[model samples]
Target: MQSCSPFDQAQRGDVEAKFQIFLTLLAVLAGTALLARRVNIAPAILLLIAGITLAFIPGMPAIELPPDLILLLVLPPLIYSASVAMSWREFCANLRPIGLLAIGCVIFTACAVAVATHYLIGLSWPVGFLLGAIVAPPDVVAPLAIARRLGLPRRIVVVLEGEGLANDATALILYRFAVAAIMTGAFSLTKASGTFVAILAGEIAFGIAVGWLSLRARHWVRDPQIEITLSLLTPYIAYWIPEHHGGSGVIATVACGLYISWNGPLLISAATRLQGIFFWDLVIYLIEGMLFLLIGFELRAILERSQGIAFEDIAVATLLVAAIVVVARFAWVYPATYLPRLLSRRIRTRETAPSWQAVFVVGFTGVRGAVSLATALALPFALPDGSPFPDRDLILFVAFGVILITLVGLGLTLPALVTTLGVARDGRSELVFEHENEIAARREALAAALTSLDALTDHRELSNQVVALLRARHDIRSQQLPASLDDDAYAATANARALVRELIAAERKFIHAQLRAGKINDEARRRIERDLDLEEASLTNRESGTAPL
Candidate 1:
């Protein structure tokens, strides 16, 4: 029987189904986002859990959001959004460790799981490797998103994101090779290496072409809604264009994502940038939320497939594979992060390359979710010699086991690890972020005070009222600032803040110069950006407000 689903209904051109599921998911996302500040866990993970609970309800047919559709339609926006938010320098600094963990660690993890499955779960070597390939890539969205929101160190966040970005290609490369070997009954290291290289090169080439071409298309269009719609379709174009020619869709999508934003300053207008930012961010959130939810939703499907497998064997194998993944991260991360610094002869580096706590945090967060489970589930539903795919049911079982062990175990454990590691120590980072907000408050008060002083020249009637309001604000900030800061720290902080204010004023001077020279205009987005620039200036700058002479 055909599965009944919102997507299926939508396909039949049911307008209600088209919007209903999307609107409901969006509303849920909105509610979760509102509560995100109060809650420590990521809203994506929360959504996944909720989706799983919903899936267990009686008479709710499974919604099969096709894996390729998610890959082609969804992943690009999320990757692009993350890329735009990334600072190039921070991402570059962590590039080495990110490569080691994403590529080398993914390989290690796949092998670990494959071995465990072959020996412990009684699967053949190639079949076990196929399972390994599935669960190998670590899902960082759940952790990295939470870490970024909590304002963890930029370096840590960059490393996690960088790992997340690159590991897709790594795991996909492995998946492709393992699946091919099973399908063709032929496997060779030399051939696998060749295929990997081709996939990488082809993906990069395809992305560069699509990303640049998309920008060109945007130049001819002025409508924000149309541009945004075009932007939404871009990832799929990038993915499918390459895949049709037998290239890696995952790498192509990621490359296209990075290319678009990496060239944003040069290629994108301020209006386009603003709309693109908002558009892609919303799309990414929806896709990321749905992707994670699907991971949990498919848990039932996995259990159904693995029903004949002995629970005792599956449990033991999962534990062993889990241990391997955890230990392998520590094995790789500690050594890899330090090796770079140790190798640097002249430049002194931080002694703590990656704190044991950070290493442990990354290690424990080995949660295998969407990519792993999807690749596993998508494992060719056929076998070599035209027979049914060999042991797909068992392979799916082990893949699910890997995911369940990693996610349920690590997701629950990561919070305690955070508390223990003191990464978010005393909740001080939140206070720091909030302080800038407070400073903005003080600036408004200063503006009102100055405005009041001016109103006296025009009319004394309104002047006194404005003065009274400004006076109240001054008194509040005056009392609050001291309690919130130590004398030396406040003064030093103020001096640092003053430097930033001067720097921004200096930057503004150049920007205005460019405007006068006809290089740019003070457009709507520039006004918004100006506010952000000043807010950033105040966050780091210590200068008191004063009227220009």
Candidate 2:
């Protein structure tokens, strides 16, 4: 049985009142976010801003952010949704780089900031480490949204996403260890390492098992609404299963997401896909919308508590930390990538490897919002000795400081960084379709030649030979088109071929430029782009001889 969250205290005897409160909160924040959006602001951004603005309103509700609010209520589903939506192939291809950035650089940032904050800021190393741990991992949603809007390079997206996906596990690991140190007044390197490994293994195992169980449950009861509800619960199951056993909730959620969606093609039938996509889409949209609003709503607490320190001190520190994070990212990114390639004498390959400028752009893209603030707010109010948590307010102040600097600072400069970095000098995406077009054209030619001979039925043996060859052509074309298309439809279809050809040409220019500029290696680029080429090509041929445009 899943354990109820500590926050579920409200969900018990006062369940109806708590439920009403919860629904009202969601409605108000969601509604305000929507209202703000009508004025051309993003709803999520509006949600946060509006929520914060409302905090000052007289008698406005100020919800205390219990630890369970973040760890249990918000995190599980968000993490699971990301995992469920993750493209496994992208994850695999970008694994090495992701590991380097997420783990190595995360650890690096934590250590760097720990030293800087401890000695310079005059805090205990453990407290400093906690602060560093919170700031090191870029908020996943922030970077993902920025990357998407900037129309950044696909390779860059992989790095950002790769780092984001894996770093959650790393940051959470460090956070756990740091929390342990604070709680027990002792830290163990060997024990930490052993614990990390155990948590990793446990999460992977637990998540996979739960996902498989969920998949079976879905198979047994294949209702779309139910499956989505199951999908919704998967994250919680993945999280609580391991947490119940003192395992990594982040890893468990990720593992469960991957497995549930692993056999997406095979497991989710056509009927399920239609229902599942809509169901999950709505669920994710609602979650994302509400979460950002919660961020602002949560911020009101931080603002109300900022009495001891002047805005100037907070501003200066925020600026300082923000600068350090950007510098630290570049300091960590370029060497982390290129140094390995230099050692192996094996040029690192990708659709777009991180250039120096790209590193700078990515570094600045670190907008610390949800996770950092939440971590700070969630910090226990008192230590085991019942002493006020050391540097607690300072940490909270700096957390907000970092968010302000990154969001306002980098957020404003992001557009300029895009052009300066030349990351997208060619275009946003690097999908190549020319090869798909060629294959399509060839298939069309072969089919046309066969059709020409089809009228010669008097020659049975020749006709049989042509038919055999045409069957082979058909098979080849099937491999080239998108998974959604059936061979008969693709080949017999008229518009498919022409549309595929145009898309392929656009892609060819994009891919070839990146290839020539050393953005992507030949082999990796080709492999990364192989299916797109095939799909586009086959689809093109199917439409090749359609009546003249």
Candidate 3:
């Protein structure tokens, strides 16, 4: 073999180093996630801390997170996943509130930041507005994860999730306008407003078109693997088209996901849904964990770059901006929640106003995350004239500070706030109500299926034995459903599920023994193992209250 050239050797060394770094990061992510679960803290918090620790360790390489890596690669799937998971009916029903928060609140908060920074920090208006837009939206992934576990009211969850889905579009649009104004030293409210409207309309139309085409294609393919591949591609298709043409891409992805969510159930096959759920779940989990870690790692680089700025000044700007973000949300949320009903009689008749406690919870959950930092980092180092961008380092430092404070401070205290306000009690009651409705729906569906089965039996020639077996199976399924969601009934159901799980374990043990003894081939064993695996998974889901009724 010939000796490798020096350049080739260097290339090989670089690749090896990168691969090692990848493995090390993966190890950190896994450990942090497990520790978070054990300590009953949000994983995002721990992941961020872990990343900070790793970043400062001697001899550890500095990892640069490209702005596009987050904007182009990570964001689409996260937004799409959330949009798909959201209930379309609930989303539409709460559209007014969602829009207020997603659109109006973002605008208000951005403007608040702009004014505060201009007067207090002495940044120019355009640069201040740009910073405002960067930090306007609360992170969807972090707060929703915590809120769902706390069992807040379903409507609150829906509104928060819905707001999170669309707020990025609002913030990003404003960000672009602010950037443009700064670069050209001019601004136009009228033209910008018209452009904003046109982008929204165009993206929505494009997103729906993408969703429709994707659904039809998946249905035609009829193969689970191919359908899953298409599902993975759907969001990118929806996002990239709009983004490439000066739109936010967020609205288009959200619209696409919602369209597919409402329409997909009837078109998608059971196998595809089943496999796709697991695939997407794992994908989102890894992506989210890694994103937070990378965010934490960015701190070291930011600190290194901030050598020229006074620590005291950076701290003051960060604290002031963070305070403004929190206070402005409360000021905006209360009015936004109640002002419409106050202004319109028709609104009063159509909607019941939420409690003050719930509104407070919404206001208190303004945790920021990766988007603000990414946007700030994406800011140009120099203006179009090759002059240094004013206050660029300060902007980056303050943005990071705001993210750290909100994510750690507000996120940690939210659960206690909800508890003190007795929101969890309302959430529990809502859960009970939902469980009752689910039971009723299940019974109605079974009855309908049985009625159809009877009609088919009357119209076609069928053996009595076959008809009897089918009837017995349906009866067994109906019997398995709990009569009510009472303590005694729930306990009985849990005990039964535990017994079924034990039986499944025993079956697996026997199957493995037979395989070891050469009683069955690998292929046969795998076939049987797959069936058993699915059955066990169903039981696990049912036990955890995640199974579909």
Candidate 4:
């Protein structure tokens, strides 16, 4: 082989550099998480601050963020993770408010922000609208994590989650229209409206098709490794198919995630289900860490790149736009939260009115994040005729400013706000409710299993030993729970199961010792071990009052 060329060597160096940067970022994240725990602060907020600090250090590597990376690499899995894990029941029950906020409130906020930008910031209508689109939707990632940690009311969290999932598509559609109008200097309201409808219908249909096909494919392929790999690909396929055909990838991804999430219990094996949850959780953690860190990196880069705009000027614009975003949310949320109940008797009767305090928390937690920065950066540097994009630098700075203010300012303050408003839900009550439901489900399942066993043991060909063993297992399961379990009864049931699990563990250790001593052959040992493995697994599920695989 010929000696490697200079270009090849350079390429190798570049790759090495990138790998080093990735490793360093991971190290930083690990350190930040530990430090955050020590300080009793949210890791996300601290990680963002750490990233900004890293940016300012001397001789630090400059990480160039590609615009498409956020949409393509970062968005799909995050959206899918949130969607699949969301409560479809709660989502549907709160559909009215979610729709009003995701659609109507998005439009309202965008319009209000646009008018503010035009009049106060002196930007043109199109550019102002573009800015509005950039900041319209609160990012799902940060707020959801915070809400869950703070233990806010479940319904309020659901509403926030629902709005985060749905609003991105709406804002993106508006962004596209505004960009088209700016570049071509032409737009049609009627045509845009029709296109919006077509896009929505097409994306939803596409998502359903992807979800259905993927689930069927998963069922046909039984291997856990293969199934888990397919799961990793599901969100991307959901996004890619729609986006390739002129539809919203965000809508497609969310739909597919929701579909899979709802049906996951039926389709997935227990092993795959557990492994997949762990894998996705890890993936989400890494993605979010990098995404927020990159936000800080981008902030410094954009500010440095901005020309002729004073720091004070950018600061003022940021403050004004930030104030607009917050006020606009309050203005829209109060009406959107309560107006439907006032107008429609059906809504009033079907749903309980949310407390005013909860509504305030929702309004205050509207923190703009990575998506906004990505949208701002994604704007074209030049129009078709080679003219520079109007106010691109200003828009970028403004967008970064809003993200910083919202993410750091509002994000850091959210816990205190919730505390002040007395809106956090009672953790014990929620746990008790879940325990009650689980107990009821277990009781029904055990009764059915026993009934089926009683009917099956009547077979003349069935062995008495096999039937007896099956009966013993079912009886043990039923005994692990009580006829009526209150908190104390549940604890007692847990203690009994713990004793059973310890006995199984002792049996497992004895079997392993026998295998090592060569008193048991490998084949005999494996047979016994498999039985022990399954028994232990069953015991674990039972202890938690979960159904057996």
Estimate, for each residue in 1-549, the C-alpha lDDT of model 1 and write its tens digit: 978798876677656665676676677667766565467666656766766776677865566657676555555566656655665566666667777888888898788777866776677888778777777788867777656555555567677887887787788778878888888778999878888888888887888888888877776686777777777777778777776776657677766766776665776666776666656666676777777666667767766667887888667766776777767666777777667677885424444465677666666667776777677667777665678887777666666666666666677667777777887653455445456566667767766866767666476556566667866866665544433444465676566556766877777777778888888877943984668575674463333221110
**Candidate 4 TM-score versus the reference:** 0.89
**Which residue pairs collide, candidate 1?**
382-389, 383-389, 497-540, 497-541, 497-542, 498-541, 498-542
Q: What is the C-alpha RMSD of each candidate to the true structure, in Å?
A: 11.5, 13.0, 1.3, 3.5
Model 1: how far residue 219 lies from native, Å: 3.4
What's model 3's overall lDDT?
A: 0.91
lDDT of 2 at 462: 66
Query: What TM-score does each of the candidates earn?
Result: 0.72, 0.73, 0.98, 0.89
lDDT winner between candidates 1 and 2: 2
Cα lDDT tens digits, model 3, 107-149, are: 9999999999999989999999999999999998888888888
Worst ten-residue run, lDDT, model 2? 540-549
Judge candidate 3 at residue 314 and give its lDDT: 94
Q: Output the better candidate (2/3) by lDDT.
A: 3
lDDT of 4 at 182: 99
Ranked by lDDT from best down, the candidates are 3, 4, 2, 1
Please give the CA lDDT of all the candidate structures. Answer: 0.69, 0.71, 0.91, 0.83
User: lDDT of model 1 at residue 333?
Assistant: 71
- Backbone clash count, each prediction separately: 7, 8, 0, 0
Clash number for model 3?
0
